[model samples]
Target: MKGFITDPLQIERESMRIIRGYLQQDWTEKELKIVERCIHTSGDPTLESVIRIHPQGIEAGLKSLQQGAPVITDVEMVRAGIAKKQLSQLGGTAECFLSDPRVADQAVELGITRSMAALRLNKERLKGAIVAIGNAPTALLEVLELAKDPETRPALVVGIPVGFVGAKESKDLLWEEHPELPSITILGNRGGSPLAATCVNALIYLAVNREI
Candidate 1:
C-alpha cells in the first residue's frame, strides 16, 4: 500500500519489514520490479492518486521498496491483469479462477482431509492414544472432543494444481454442492507444501480473523 520513490536503500528496508517471509519466493523479483516501476513512473501521488497496479506489480513494488530500488510502473499492464469476466461471473464475491475443475475440488477435499487428520490424529506416528479395535467408539468420542479446540483447526487450505484431471467436477462439488465455507481455488497445476499451503493457510487465517 505504501507507494513512493525514496532511495534504493530505504525501499529495500521497507520491503524487508513488510514482506519478511515471502522475500524468498520466486515471484519476489517480479514484484520488486513492478513496484519500482509504478512509483517512478507515476510521479508522487502519495495515497490520494488511487494509482492502479497489477497484483504482480504491487508485489514487485513492495520488494523494490524493501530492497531500496526505484520503481517505474506501467498502469496499462496492471489493468490488463484484472479478470473482468471472471470477476463478473462470481459476482465479485468469490476468488475461484481455475479453468480446471478437479484442481478446485481437490483443494476443498484436501482441506477436509487435513482437518479430519488433525481432528482424529489418524496418522500412525500420532502420540495421542493407543487403543484396540474394540475401543473404536471411544476414539471417535475423543476426536469429537478435540475438534472443539480452536488451536487444532486448519488455518487455511488451497489447491491450484495445474493439469488437474477432474478439476470441473471438483469445483462443482465445492461451489454447487457445499458453498458455506470460505475458500480460494487457483488455476494451473503446480502444488506443494510451500506455495499451496502458504496460500491456504493465509486464507484460513484471514477467514478466521474475519478478513474474507
Candidate 2:
C-alpha cells in the first residue's frame, strides 16, 4: 500500500486531477482553476452548476489585481479568507468595511442596510477595486446602485451572497441591471464566504501564475 500523501503541493495537484476528472464540460484554463478551487473549497461538485462569469470578467479581474487595485470584501470572513500574502505580493490589499462603526451609524441615518451603508462609506476605495460580496444580499444590491455612478463603480464585482430571501433577486438584478459591468456570480441563493474568497483567490492565482 502507498503511504498517505503528506506533501501539500502534491496533495493539491492530486486534488486538482480528481476535480478535473469529475468535470465533463470544457472550460478555459482560468475558468477551470476558479471552478476547481470552488469545488476544492466546498467539496461540492454542484458548485459548477451555478457558477456564472461574465465574458470579460476574468480578464478584467486579473488586470485589476495586476494594477494593485484594492479588494473590498463585504464581510470580515470574506476578508479573512482572502490570500493576503498573495495580494500584498501583487501590491494590493484586502479590506472589509462592514465592521466600521461609521457603517452602523450611517445605516441608521440613511435608513439603509448596514451592508449598504458600508459600501457607501467605502465608495471611494471601491472605485476600480475588486469588490467581493459573499454574505449579504443587501451588499450586492448596494453594488448595483453604486455602479450607476461612474466614480464609485468597481473594476470587478464578485456578487455571490448567500440567502433565500433576497439573494436570488439581488443577483438577477445584477444581471439585468448592469450587463456592462464585469462580474462573477452564482445564479441561485447558494453562495458563501468560502466560495467568494475562492473566486478572488483564483484571480490572485491567475496573477501569480501570469496566466492572464
Highest-scoring model, TM-score: 2
Q: Alpha-carbon error at 86 in model 1, in Å?
A: 34
Candidate 2 is scored at a TM of 0.94
| Candidate 1 structure lDDT | 0.28
Each candidate: what lDDT?
Answer: 0.28, 0.89
How close is every model to the real structure, measured as TM-score? 0.24, 0.94
lDDT of 1 at 101: 39
Give per-residue lDDT, candidate 1, residue 140.
Answer: 23
- What CA RMSD would you report for each candidate? 19.6, 1.9
User: Per-residue alpha-carbon lDDT of model 2 for 1-212, expressed as tens digits?
Assistant: 38999888888989988888888677898888888998899898887887888888999999999999999999999999999998999999999987888988899888989989988887988888999999999999888888889899899999999989999999988867788999999888888999899999999989998332
Error at 183, model 2, angstroms: 0.6
